[model samples]
Target: MAELVLDPESHFPEELGIYFWLYPYWDQVSVRGCGYMVRWGTPPLVISILKFTPLAFMVTWNAHPGFTIPHTNLCDFIVGNGAAPVDLPLGFSNIPPQRYPEAPGDEGIVLHTPLAYIAERSK
Candidate 1:
């Protein structure tokens, strides 16, 4: 497995007002009729270190042979106020290194979440 590192200087989305990191793994498999398919595996199975709450989060994936299988490629994370949401962000390289506008309140917390997603391929 290759390691994907996040640039500490990167900025989170203004709408979300939080920073996040993503790690992805890809596995290849062979289908009976299909020539090849990619099966995304589970996340790294580790909790994010950063502590921050989030309104909601989502994950999406794409493959070369689109829609050959009957799998839905959308994943979502919804966190309420009571519990603190993971600090990680969504999608690999989704948040680029840049500056973000400060939130309305100065005391507002800046959260950084780390999330991992896995995908599989069939050959």
Candidate 2:
């Protein structure tokens, strides 16, 4: 489990985005899926419940897929007190990532598009 605590005073007043890449070893099923949750000033939000096929992981690490923080119900989340801890907890599951939240099956080999957010926010 990796937790990222964003300092509001230093990070706020502007929108922020997160991105990552997964490169599981080809030997076996490196991971069942990856879970991401955000705890801002308000109630916690589940950002992503993602998985990959074995074929996806078997490729060269450099060829692994890139993932961006999708736009979920986060627009309202941006409007916050900027005092409470803004926590981002990311994890991988060999079993289920969490029980209360059930993950979906077979998200396919590539999770997200290769496009990035430019200054104009164009794809």
Candidate 3:
């Protein structure tokens, strides 16, 4: 029998990862035949049965021909290894970077540079 190898480009995941902002709206996550925009938030997890997944979805959806994240796109995929769970502190959406310490109760700090942005940038 001939062996078949699935390259990264052709691999399709059984489930998809979800962004944290969509956590509350997990019910809204669906597999549309078209495609979906995915951006990393915290870590990979399965919320209920949603898979709360991220990487898999991106690869699968993007595998389709002519897939693209537009120049005018409002979002970009925040990539992560999805290796483990993320434990964010209260009101802190992302893990604080070494250069920038967590500023609790400091709205000004976030106004210009949000922790989420910092985390995304760190990635």
Candidate 4:
């Protein structure tokens, strides 16, 4: 990876040790491709052994990303929240990026996660 130069116009105040705090993560496994901490889906998805293009990557669970629960628990303190079960299949895929959140009723093809979600998943 190339050197990460902090922009002079950064949003932080001029005196805090923010750069020192961020250096570890900012310098960790950054690559030409992005990294993601995804919820591994059950019924593991299979794919062809074809070689990936320069932009392709597999979202494995190493690097101690902390395994996320496969299901959602919605238990309230007083009224008791309803169960928001996470029924999503948890495996990762190297599918190409697409302009998702497609037109209404075109739900069949969509990568529902937000860009921020994709970016922050690794954190």
Candidate 5:
């Protein structure tokens, strides 16, 4: 099992908009991926993983009706309340990055994870 945490300062959003946070776990023993979803409305903003990697993964946004934003991971541009800490299942794939390709979707502006989680998991 691996423990994951979200950095409040790095992951929190300063303004309101579609936001996403990704947790990528990769190691010789296993690779686990997990995170949360937030939106302005019911069901909140839903985010799904289209591709996974040791270093990073690609996520897609599923906005509710009236939400016209394209699917994209906006982890870089927008700031948010940061990612809430969560626990994820453990397992890994032998697949390589080239085997998985990024699809067209909304741009992810805010991407971050907790430094503690990474450190603990790496150990």
Candidate 6:
């Protein structure tokens, strides 16, 4: 299981739309056990993964209508206080930066993680 920890430095000053696209090699995968911890106030995070294929999906987040608090101060509530653990299938390898065929000009950041969660399995 791979859990996403929203680091304090990665927190956004305001509500920003974030997204992630995943394409695995497994026949099927499941994501469960999502929760949050309350600090000074509720963190803005409500993630939902829409699985389009057996090994492909898109990650999305929707802030709670009531948790509309601006992140003006660093001492205030943290961003992404609540993140879920993603259950990855077996035999997953590395995640190399391949040019997205659809968007060859697009580029993304490389995140350093202990576990190989967001990796592509060689067919």
State, as a TM-score between 0 and 1, how close model 1 is to the true structure.
Answer: 0.15
What TM-score does candidate 4 get on C-alpha atoms?
Answer: 0.13
**Local distance difference test scores for all models:** 0.25, 0.28, 0.24, 0.23, 0.33, 0.32
lDDT for each residue of candidate 6 in 18-95, tens digit (9 for 90 to 100): 333344434333332233222335552433222323233323245565543221222123335433344433223443
TM-score of each: 0.15, 0.20, 0.18, 0.13, 0.22, 0.23
The predicted structure with the larger lDDT, 1 or 4, is: 1
Q: Of 5 and 6, which scores higher on lDDT?
A: 5
Best by lDDT: 5
Selected candidate, larger TM-score, 1 vs 4 = 1
- At residue 113, candidate 2 shows an lDDT of 28
- The digit string of per-residue lDDT tens for model 1 on 41-86 reads 4221111122123211122223233323222221223243313455
Q: What is the C-alpha RMSD of each candidate to the true structure, in Å?
A: 20.0, 15.9, 16.6, 18.9, 13.7, 15.4
lDDT of 3 by residue, 1-123 (tens): 011123423322323332222121112222223212232332221111122322111122223233332112111332233233554322224422222112224321211222122212222
* Local distance difference test, candidate 2: 0.28
lDDT of 3 at 53: 20
Off by over 4 Å in 2: 1-6, 12-71, 84-108, 111-123
Off by over 4 Å in 5: 1-53, 63-83, 94-97, 103-123
Prediction 5 global C-alpha lDDT: 0.33
Error of 5 at 69 (Å): 20
User: Model 4, range 54-112, lDDT digits (tens) per residue?
Assistant: 22222222223243322211111112121234332223433323321121133232222
- Sort all candidates by lDDT, best to worst: 5, 6, 2, 1, 3, 4
